[model samples]
Target chain A: MVQKYTSMAYASADDLVFGKAKFPVKAGLGLEIGAGYTTPEINYAPRPQAGKSKEKLIKEYERITTDSMQRMVQIGAPSVVLETEHVEQMTNNPSWGGEVAHAQKTIMEEYHDEYGIKCALRHTPGDIREDRDFLKLRGDKYDLLMESFEQIAQNGADLLSIESMGGKEVFDYSILRNDTAGILFGIGVLGSMDMEMIWSDIADIAKKNNVVAAGDTDCAQANTAMFIAGGLLDKNLAHTIAIVARAISAGRSLCAYEAGATGPGKDCGYENTIIKSISGVPIAQEGKSSTCAHSDVMGNLVMQACDLWSNESVEYHGEFGGTSVQCWGESLAYDCSLMNVALKTGKEKGLRDLFTLSDKYRDPQGYVLAYENAYRVGQAIVKDGTDNYLRTKNAAVECCTILDEGIASGKLRLTRFETKALAKVQADLAALPDNSDQFMSDCLTKYKEEVAVFRPENYGL
Target chain B: MLDLKKEDIDGILIRYNVSLEKEMTPDEAAEELYPKDELIYPIAKAIYEGEEDDVIDGLKAAIDAGKNPIALINDALMVGMGVVSQLYDEGIIFLPNVMMSADAMLDGIEYCKDQTDEVPEPKGTVVCHVAEGDVHDIGKNIVAALLRANGFDVVDLGRDCPVDEVIEAVEKEKPILVTGTALMTTTMYAFKEVNDKLLEKGIKVPFACGGGAVNQDFVSQYELGVYGEEAADAPKIAEFILASGDGIEKLREEFHKH
Candidate 1:
């Protein structure tokens, strides 16, 4: 059975320092994440043409893996995480994913034995159930997803992670309308149920294989909001709504840790900051450095308390300076080096402040993600921790309150439209009944009719 | 225009993080926020502020003043949205501001349509959808809205629409163009499946695919695929399709950066 976090591992926000965690998990080669120093987690994908043949795919993986580790060795990276996000082709063909994982792990082992460079392979299989009706979460594709996870763990992967897509159907609908209650029902309740179901099995797989079930990310929910809010492409979704959705996602992602995932959660989960504060586990964060994969407003600020600094993901190709992995590896390694230097000089807090203040006021998303605000959201989550619905609702309320205060105090800048949105979101959240059962039932009756794809039965309502 | 004192205007500038020139006046700052024409200012400001009721009031006043409703849409409503888009591009404004402004502009357009007895012909028809199995549709939604704003009739196929549904929509709607967005690598392959099915059926509607996981290379590999680098590019692509007579290579040549 999973034990839900009811209290914070750190006494206060001040105690939540970078490169240190109250709960650290040791993985391959006796390397410890979230124990003493931050490490670079490098993620890359094979070129598109590799999908044409299994041989080409494996060969591409081998090239990128060896190339990245060699650069890590040259950079003298203390420890590195290589996240292999299995493409859809691999999930459909489970054996292909296993072979790729085995090959990459073998490369990691060879590098470690040769140069004393510690590394871990985080095998992230695609959530194949999303290919169809993810609501059912049981079918040939679902079976393949689970089997792929087990296969990778047994094939020398040190950590396991998946950007699971549970409750995304409803999240997509609710976020478009900026419906806070609907979002709560979708991510808070439906997403938690899916996380518990999947992570319970994944936790067992990790235990059986003696590997760490790292964590899950709210990529489908929160990251979608972040992407929409960051660029000028989509203007319908509010940054205020995105920030609140991120806080709500904390409850959903927390289910993974509750179900036995240890430390160093996935990199793309901007919600990992709050999860780190709540669960006190090592977290992998991607920020300004992640521009190779995507852009965001909080690149500098996200580094405030990360244990594993990542470049999100870069394609396996060459750049002007070097291959994508080599170039991004140096970028990530240098960032880690700065933090390590700060830790050595006992100036970690000073460096953390610079990171936090630089991007805090640039966007509401960044303001809420600042470590101080994340801790507040964390406190709100744990205050109602036992109840998934209530915890997420509390987190959203805290985020809104934080933004409201920031705007009122003239610390956070927002346009007139954004200010109006913040008010509307706060009012909408306030309108929801404080009772979780009432909120869930009301959302069920409402969203069932409003959202065509939403079914309460999928969430075990 | 915006009947605000200097303090209120300064407060607006501060809230939006807009720096004024050393000696710029509050009037100039207001003009910077929206157009400064007597007839267009109120409507533009209403749209910029996303005030739907005010937009309606401004449109009613413009109509009473014997202004052409369609001209108001082109000059005032679209112009106001243009300002909002520019502010967003400059990072002075954000998504919520754009959404509200879009809502206000659309409302103004609807009001203008109500005032006119003759139906305004749309430039063309387009069908937009998020790729199958991918529920991230904000990009699709924005593209659809922009297309509608540019006077195109958009048949919106909402998020996670299956491949069959897309093909069915195309066959039924007979749209001039179709677009697909996918934010995940796993789901992006569904775009290829969609294009292939369209090819098998001999439906040669120009297909524009984009999103985080999609690139020009992936789209170029398939026939009838035009990569959209931004949501703003959708309407331009639709215009290009209408003008160029559905040539995929030309459409790609004009739009795809890489």
Candidate 2:
């Protein structure tokens, strides 16, 4: 039986520091994450040409893994986590994902044996539900997805992760209109239910295979908001709403841990910081180093409390400096080295404070991502942890209060437009009924008629 | 009442990385970011401030003073949104501000439409959808909104739309252009499938594909594909398609920054 977190794992947020966790996970040749030192987690994707055939895909994986491992050894890297996020084609063909995982893990093991470099292979298969109907998680596609996970784990994957998409149809609709109630239902309630079901099965699979079910990411929900709010894609969503959506996503992502998966959690889930504070699990975070893949405002700030520093994902192709994976891996390794040096010198908190203060005043998203603010949000999340709705709602309200205080104290700056948007978000979140049942009832009645694809049965409402 | 402690003040300053002597008030920081203008300033202010009622009042007053409704939309409302768009580009304003401004601008447009007897016709119709298996549609929504604001009719297929649904919409709507967005590498392949099916049916309605996962290299690989670099670029691309023929090669040459 898997233990679930019922209360805050640490006595205080101050006790929650980088390179340490209440429950550190050991994987692949004595490489421990969240123990006492930080490690680089390098995530890379095969080039588009690899999609030609399974053999080609496997070859590409081998090349990338060998190249990355060789580079790590050359740089005298302490340890690394290599994550293989299977594409749609690989997941559709479960053996393909298994073959790739086996190929990469073989190389990783070889490097560990020959060079004494600690490494772990994290296999993240694609969520194979082609349509938005996540409720129908039983079909050829669903079976293939589950089969891919089993094969990857059995084929030598040390860690299992999936960017699961549930309640996203409603989340998309609700976030467009900045509807707080719809967000609460979609991410908090519906999303939590789906995570429980899927993660419970995944945790069982991990246990059976002697692999760790690392964690799930709210990439579809929180990352979408983060991407949009970062102003690269669209500006129709506000950073204020994005930060709140992130807080709500923390409750949903927490369901994965509750279902028995341990840390370090996925890197892209910006909500991972708050989850780390709550569950006291190791968390992998990506920011400035991930610019090769994406951009965000919290580049420096998100690094404040990360155990596994990652480069998100770089496509395995040649660059001016080197191959994409090698160059980005070096970037991530250097950042991890800096953090490790700080940890060794007992200046980790000083470095963490620098990371926090550099970007904390730049954006409200950054402001809330600061370790202290993340701890406050974590406190709100656990305050009503039993109820998904209340915990997520409380987290959102807490984030808003943090932003308000930051703005009030002139620690953070915002344009008039942003100030107004923040006010609107606060007002909208505050307007929701305090009772979870009332909020659920109101959302069911309102969003059922409003969001066209939000089926009550999908969430088992 | 003023219980000021030196350590407390030092702690606050150190944590925030701000000196008490040089710290600016929130109002002082906001003062420089606000847009300034004369005739159209109030309407534009209403747009950036996201005050819909204020926008409507300003529109009604401008219309009462005998300004052209169409010109008011172009000069006042769109201009107001333009300020927001610029502020957003400069990082002075954020997404929420843009969303509220878009709402206020749309409300102003609707009010203007009601007041004017002769409403201008839209440039053309465009079908927009997020790619199959991808639920992120805020980018698509913004694209549709920008297209509509630029006087183009948009048939948004919403998020996670099936390829068959998109093909069916194209068959029925016969729009001048089609757009798809996908936020994941796994899901972005759906764009290629949609393009292939559209080509199989001999429906080459210039698909403008973009999102976080998509780039020019991916979009340019297929026929009738144009990479939309930003949501704001949607209107310009649509106008180009309306004026110039739907030549995918030319569209890719003109757009697709990378």
Candidate 3:
């Protein structure tokens, strides 16, 4: 019972970075934004106008979402995510939350009607119970979500994302019962106990169905994501590691993005640099406060590294255990490449996390080449014959070491030119120092300046 | 360090173990199950881990030991809870652990009081709740637990609580601080309603509001509206108002901006 994965991903993954060419929208890629009119913070607005029927409030929410989706389509976004709250969850309506589901479906219809793009309706039930409590759904009121989902699919939902935050019970049920064109797990914040198990389960399902695993990479801010971010837990590193591990083993692509700074700016890494707290991770600390942006910068780099290594690790097709490709740690070379791009070339592309920030794999081989070229010179210092770093504990050194186990079989799919380029970068990074902060900071400063333009006014929903 | 096993310790929750971060390690799990203090460890262990039965049984035993009521209060129980506060801050512990720990701490204190005929006055009373339109209270629940652990008597007005109910609790309780949490945008306005009603009644209670959807800009718009950024800020806010006596304006100046 070996795991199968996608091995026939394009020869040049860089070309697929911004997502596959949009016949109308990016195929197999989409961003899930909590739609509805919200205040400066992304909470449900119109709370002031109370006693409005569920229908009326939903209509207002749909109107606001329709506007946002049109803007998204204009920007060449491949997929749109529209989520609906339970009638009981939203207002005190007992009419099965059907209208609420249909309201989301209508937004999808309107988006398709206008831009003809596919939309994923994330049916959000209030009871986001985990495996422990989710099983209590036998006769629970949330069964209405299943009913509403049927109608939405019939009306033309391109994708039915079981919005089970960290809950898999509902996800399993949705995929089994629904006849939607596509099934995905709306894992905004994976607060589950066994994340690797969840990814494995998702991979198992993708073996048979067209499935995607999406998550919010904002790291900290709200209910679940906040604990990871504000606590300064080292779980961020675990997340990237798990994604690549799963990418090689699971037959699904991992999609991760941010929820934006819609809450306290300092808490969510909005405008502030880093705010120190007792909960901060020790390794990610600067003086006292956790360097929030630095952790994120590292997070972005690790994920892109995952894509590169996973892209070449296992020769998985949609078929299960097609070819047992050992991951020869080719991704390590890519990571070294990125470090060179950041430190030597002084480029911002070197720092982007492909899962959350970009759709493209920015010049990974180029960065590796730059790193290798520098290591040959005294551009990077090496301490102890073993401790090679661009700087002390350079972020890339830890990141690449994280993927040292995966050994892909067969000669890597790199072209002769690509192969020479990668070899050159690997050579340059051979004796680098672990001083990542210097290289990481330069890239982060540039990244922050670039990302400031895309901050959403609101965040939590 | 005690030789007691997990099952012997009683009250540690193995399930409900997932947080945004990693799972609790076996060391943390062991520390939680077995109280460090060997003497009244049962009480602390019961409270810290998850056992009401152990708490009750241990309290009776301490009373039977004829332990000095006051000495027991200051040394054994407080020391255990001090560890709890630190573990909580480190995100190494859970609320149920703290809640049961506080209960054990209180039961020991109460047993000592009954024996010595001593009745200690509570440090202060605090009223907490989620806003009228929001039903999410896990954050509020955490705040109340921390406040209780820190020695304040918290009157929790449950989530989806109406403005009148919160104001009623505040008026009746005459608390030092009244806090409301909301994770929805629509319900944030309810914080303003509570503020206006409190103002109308000439009750000048400090109203703290925060949660997922609450913004400093939004909460600051209402009177007596001081924004609490996280649940961890709850006990700190209580200590601030009680210690400084600087009122709401001073709090706003320190913790929030327009």
- In model 1, where do residues sit more than 4 Å from their true spots? A131-134, A138-140, A231-236, B1-123, B127-138, B141-174, B184-205, B216-225, B243-258
* Residue-level lDDT tens digits of model 1 in B150-229: 66888998878899999999999998999999876657777888889999999999999998878888888888899998
> Model 3: which docking level applies?
incorrect
Tens-place lDDT per residue, model 1, A344-434, is: 9999988898788767776788889888889999999999899988899899999998998887776565765566678888888888888
Tell me the TM-score for chain B of model 2. 0.73
Error of 2 at A292 (Å): 0.6
Query: Residues A146-182, candidate 3, lDDT per residue (tens digit)?
Result: 4444443343232333322332322222122220100
Pick by DockQ: which candidate is best? 2
lDDT of 2 by residue, B1-258 (tens): 012233343443342212222244323434444446455667877877788999998887887787888788887887777766666564454454566678788888888888878775566899999987666666888888777656677898987898899999999999999999987665677788889999999987899988876888888888878999788678789889888988888888899787
Write down the lDDT of every candidate, Cα atoms only.
Answer: 0.82, 0.80, 0.40
Candidate 1 chain A lDDT trough over 10 residues, lowest sum: A130-139
Interface RMSD of 1: 10.5
- Candidate 3, residue B122: CA error in Å? 1.0
DockQ for every prediction shown: 0.14, 0.17, 0.07
lDDT of 3 by residue, B1-258 (tens): 012232431232111112243455524644754545556776665555545567657667776787666666655556567667666666565443565567567776676677676666677888988776555555786678778778788998777788899888988989999889976666677788889999999998888887765778777788788898867677888888888973888898877844
In candidate 3, residue B221 scores what lDDT? 85
TM-scores, each model vs. reference: 0.81, 0.82, 0.49
Candidate 1 vs candidate 3, DockQ winner: 1
